[model samples]
Target: MCVKCDNCGAEIGLDGVCKFCGTVLPPREPVAPPPVAPGWGTPPPRPVFSIPQPRVPVQQPVQAASPKSRWVAILLWLLLGYLGAHQFYAGKVGMGILYLFTFGLCGIGWVIDGVSLFAGSFRDRYGLPIRV
Candidate 1:
């Protein structure tokens, strides 16, 4: 048997509640009970789904920075970058030699290395990202 809404003529459930608009239905009239067979047994209750509800969003792992190249650059600048020592440390042998011949040109290469260190743009020989 189905319940219905008088205002909208929509079908409701036994709860006297309409699923569509959640409107309450009028009370049902009492009816006579039907006869039952002697051997019939009651059915089990329906199962409930309490949860396994999703909560927080997942995040990705953070990657670490490499320091090999940056340190070499700094070291070269300190030891010989006044004459492009650090350029050689960064694997640029030609520039290092040029700076060496030029007496480090007022230490310009060393200064650039200092700036690169602060800017977090210097990388290692393996091409990994450098951490500041």
Candidate 2:
């Protein structure tokens, strides 16, 4: 026997509703996974990541000092003469800057400056010999 929907008068099936009746259906249950065998016990290994760093040379801070005495200038010449430390020490700023740029005129001017400082003939920026 065919059952009829009361609202639409259409033929219904075992689901108790006809196609044109717009009845709501029940929700389905979630599916379960199949059982695993006895011995699958090892954990997954972790991935290793290596990060690269940029290469840069280390630098040292410069300590600049300008001394007033010829003795100090001579000492600086003996120690850091090629770098124009003596000219800076003697208060010859322009010569010091030139010496700094030219590496004491490729060490020849450094030798002459050292000798002049020792001989008491090296003059300051004011044309005055550095005081002992």
The clash numbers for all candidates, in the given order, read: 6, 0
Candidate 1 off by > 4 Å: 1-67, 123-132
Q: Write the per-residue lDDT of candidate 1 for residues 34-120, one digit (tens) a residue.
A: 856666666657899897988988888876766455665666666666777566655566766877787765566557667876676
Residue clash pairs of candidate 1: 69-124, 76-86, 80-85, 81-85, 82-104, 83-104
How well does candidate 2 score on lDDT at residue 6? 70
* Residue pairs with backbone atoms closer than 3 Å in model 2 (clashes): none
Off by over 4 Å in 2: 1-67
Summarize candidate 2's per-residue lDDT along 7-126 as a digit string, tens digits.
788776677556887653443365686666556655557898989889888889753332368888888998888889888776777888888899999999999988888887887776
What lDDT would each prediction earn against the true structure?
0.67, 0.77
TM-score, predicted candidate 2 vs. hidden true structure: 0.47
Question: Each model's TM-score, in the order given?
Answer: 0.38, 0.47
